[model samples]
Target chain A: MSKEMTGAEMVIQALKDQGVDHLFGYPGGAVLPIYDALFQQNHIEHILVRHEQAALHSAEGYARSSGKVGVVLVTSGPGATNAVTGLADALMDSIPLVCISGQVATHLIGNDAFQECDTVGITRPCTKHNYLVRDINDLARILHEAFYVAQNGRPGPVVVDIPKDVQFAKGTYVGRENIEHKTYKPKLVGDNDKIQQAVEMISAAKRPIFYTGGGVINSGPAASRALRELARLTGVPVTSTLMGLGAFPAANSQWLGMLGMHGTYEANMTMHDCDVMVCIGARFDDRITGRLDAFSPGSKKIHIDIDPSSINKNVKVDLPIIGDCTKVLEALITTWKSQDRHIDRDALDAWWAQIGRWRARNSLAYRQVADVIKPQQAIERLYAATKDRDVYISTEVGQHQMWAAQFFRFEEPNRWMTSGGLGTMGYGLPAAIGAQIAHPDALCIDIAGEASIQMNIQEMATAIQFNLPVKVFILNNRYMGMVRQWQELLHGGRYSHSYSEALPDFVKLSEAYGGVGIRCEKPGDLDAAIQEMINVKRPVIFDCIVDQQENCFPMIPSGRAHNEMILGDMAIDLDAAISDEGKMLV
Target chain B: MSLAQEKTERHTLSVLVDNEPGVLARVIGLFSGRGYNIDSLTVSEVSQEGHLSRITIVTTGTPMVIEQIRNQLDRLVPVHRVRDLTVEAISLERELAMVKVRGTGEARSEALRLGEAFRARVIDATTESFVFEITGKSDKIDQFALLMQPLGLVEVSRTGTVAISRGPEAM
Candidate 1:
């Protein structure tokens, strides 16, 4: 049915039709009309965030946790500029986001009027697509199209900049049914010939590995199921990127933890030595493939990704399959079963034995301190307390993020949300808020660092305002631990400015923000404190003081090949000889 | 790129993009941000009904660098298609330039003589000065302009290169 409505009303109506239940936003003069329209409606719940950046990150959290296209509303100028970081983050990670920002009136856009800036100009490179809606009649269509483009092929963030004048004008409200475009249809099915080639490579391999990535999770739960099934049927060891962690069951015997800069010994070795590598849904980023020339030097690679540009852009593959991960996996399984092909059990057993020897290195080993808690120990306790429950994990960047990825075992997709590509600091708190809002009854926690957590600490107000029982687990290590670690190893131990001197007390800060706080300094009290934070039906910031000098290891120094990795088992003596180049102490 | 084959080659690329604000900026930003040199650039709306604009860029780079530029341009969302006219073997390229010559006596008469040889028409004339309008390939205009430079050439304004493939198929 056609209905005449104001531009603001049309936006709300379009969002309603598109099944957007929650919106994260911060109001300003340019977006006042949209806020007014929101005030009159009860169908869509509006979440007022403390900052525009937090709104986008929180929406990201909500999107990443629930597999929904997150929505955001902000005013023009600073409001839009504040969102640039989050937009870049979403773009690099392929997170689906629709950000609607209000611009100055159309007549005053060219003039230096109040809060007027070229928002579309600033955001063009950072967004998947963007629009500047001039006519009121086009507003509804543009809004719906924004949602479609954000959630469609190789999903990423899309922006719609609406001038204030359009918000006051009247327009016809056309829903999603009437807002289709002919130019942007993305192909979903992989080419059959290429799928056959990949299946053949998989069936004939000896040292085979399934190197999965975030694309599997983004392809939805079916892709993850297909991946587990493929691993079971093929008896292939699976190694995931940091973003691809939960796509394969972490608890499964075939799982090789994560493979990257700080990844486990077995995982990195497996990647280096695999003969037939099936890489699903992950880009070969520099972080994943350190010193690309020496990466998987002998592997016959099969890369399956939805985006065609990502194929052969970084590392060329023997066979590139462009399709959704779910559909491609289904095709591979069908072909493998129909051909009645099986991997030679003797050669596979040899590969498994080689992997077992690598796993025995215990690269993650660290000496325990009796008085102070180690960051790794903190994550271990956090996992032990929450392993049996339904939990969603989010993280800020640095050493703590690596610890969380290493220590926390995620058996399901869409349960772990972190800023992987951009590695934006202060992403965890607001993301946790968004996750908590989406799954209110589930346990959502932001595993954070003392230095990184302060970046978006203001979002604590939003959690209290909404009464979200989100837990903030801070591994308080006094320094920007990652930066300090690098400086110590790479720069002759000149700490520079990596330390935060006048840090605020988290217990006091949490109380000031009208939430509960707990500080666990001793290793013995870690589990009980975690239990308390979980049981408290309000936002709790658990400040677990940790060892400051500890560094994240399994380190491949910058520009070094993957095979030249330094394990942490003899880390203490290596730390003592700061300038020694790969000298052994064992 | 190898040290033995490091010589740069000039290539012209024709790109079709959405006709909207900031689309041009995005294209130029890609070039400038990557430190690639643009020798000549021109843009205009080619299809009003389709709301599509065409941009022609002349750049010099190695084969590997040229391929990188093409791949990066292809990655832009609003860019519908990009065709390398240099790589297509058969294509037509043209540019128009208006050259003004300020002189009296023999210099002015010599300018007219050169204009006739180059097929440049005298679009505007005075007793002491004349403006000649010439249209041809960029190299032809460059040669004609060089001849006019000694013949009392004052100022020259030239539209950048515009090209099209020599076939019925439209890009």
Candidate 2:
């Protein structure tokens, strides 16, 4: 059945039909009609954000935590342009989002009229798909399709550009059930032959490792369960990328920590020495692969991913299976159970012994001083204080983000959110606010750096306005720690513009936003400060002053192989660290 | 195998995609953005009712790079199928070119002589100039244009290469 309604009303109805309960956006002239219609409806709550970029990042956080497609609405021109970075971030990290931007009237699109821009054209490369609603009759259909496209296989952001006239025009509303997509169907199940082959490889190999990534989390909780079952059935050790940290339980004896730059010594060593590498749901990104020529040179790799393009993009594989992670893992488990063959126990023991020796190095070790707070120690204390609570963690891109990933142990999926691919600096604060809105009772915290947190400091107002108790834990080192570390090691310690010269007092700033603030300068005061920040019933900014000269360790310097990482205790000669080959890579 | 050991080769890929606005731009943008080389490209609508368009692209890359291109093209939402005509099957390739020569005396006759030898049709003619239309493989077109250079070749406009497999079944 179809009913005649204005386009703005249809937009609301379509979102309702799609089960969207919250939308993050800011109002402007081009989107006034949609805003007016939004005001008339109470089913969907509008989250007014200070900046469009914050709006996008907040939706990303909401989507990452809740396993739902996040929604955003904004006006034309600058509004659409401001959302580009977030869209690119979502695209790289495979977050599902649907961003709706209002454009000028259809007749005024190309005439340089007020607030007119080519939204679809600008977002084409960043979005999974995009559409311009030239006719009001197509608005409802496009809105539903945008949601469908955003949440489907290898999900990414989608954009729907609606002109002002189309939002006000009267048109027939089309229900989602009436629409049939002809060209968009993703495969869900793996081929039986490939599953059998994978089982044979796993059962015969003496040394094997399961390398996982964010796709397992994106595949939902069932996939993570399947992963655990498969690991138990095969008695194989597992490791993950930075984005895949929570997919496997960190407390499991068979689990190796994250494997890449700044990863654990055991994880990277096993990745290099494994005979058969079972890569499930992870792309071999440049950061993960290190030097492509030397990456897992002896491994006969088997890759399972929903996106076929991810397989063999950077590292070649012996077998490739295209299917959803859960469905494919279920098939692999069934196949492995049916096979009667067993792995060589003696060789597996030898492999584990070698891995134990690497773990003995304690690659994440950092000396704790009596007066100053170490960043790693701060993260450890924060984790210990919140380990038993229902918590979600997000982080900005820098040394502090790496420390959070290393120290925060997650037993389940969807509890940790960070910018893994694009490495955006200001992603954590808004993302935390978004996650807080999704899970109102859960403790949502943004582990931030002094330099990174300032990138989106305006989001403090959004948190206070919504009465969100999200906490921003800043490891204040008074420098862009990652950049400074690289400068010291690779650029003769030039340190050009790497220091935070004129930083604001975050505690005062938080107080100014009608929120609580806590500052801890000594190691002895850290735990109480974190507790105070957590107990506050509103947004709080906890500034923990840390060692300024510290650097993230166990790092595979640029163009270096996995086995050639520099541990925390190892003394580094700057000249030797910056090799000619390292200079060739970014 | 390491990247340095692989030999670089040219491959022709045929892509079937939705015949919609910005589809061509998406294809072209992907090439430029990824730093992939596009030697030649041709696109035309193949099915009006189905709203399908076929694009033929000639690119040069290592074996791994070529595979990457095919996988990347297949990942596009609007794309239906991607076939590397050079390796998938026995294929035929062709292109069309229109060459104009501006010469009055012996050079004009010489241009006409060479055009006839290449089986080129004189589509437009004047007392001082002649426009010849020719169709053949890309290499053959290149050879013809090279021969026309000494014959006062004023201008040449050539369609990029288009290719199809030699089989009873459709791709």
Pairs of residues at least 3 apart in sequence or in different chains that clash in candidate 1 = none
Expressed as tens digits, the lDDT of each residue in B1-171 for candidate 2 is 578788999999999999988899989988998989999999999999999999999999998889989988987878999999999988999999999988988888888999999999999999998999999999988999999898888899999999999979787
Interface DockQ of candidate 1: 0.31
True contacts kept of each: 0.16, 0.62
User: What TM-score does candidate 2 get on C-alpha atoms?
Assistant: 0.98
For all predicted structures, in order, the TM-scores are 0.93, 0.98
Predicted candidate 2 versus true structure: per-residue lDDT over A255-352, tens digit per residue: 98988988888999999999999999899998888888999999999999999888878888999999999999999988777775567888888888
Model 1 off-target regions past 4 Å? A571-586, B1-11, B34-37, B60-72, B86-89, B100-122, B125-132, B142-155
TM-score of the first chain alone, every candidate:
0.97, 0.99
Best TM-score among the predictions, by candidate number: 2
Candidate 2: which pairs clash?
A: none
Docking class of 2: medium
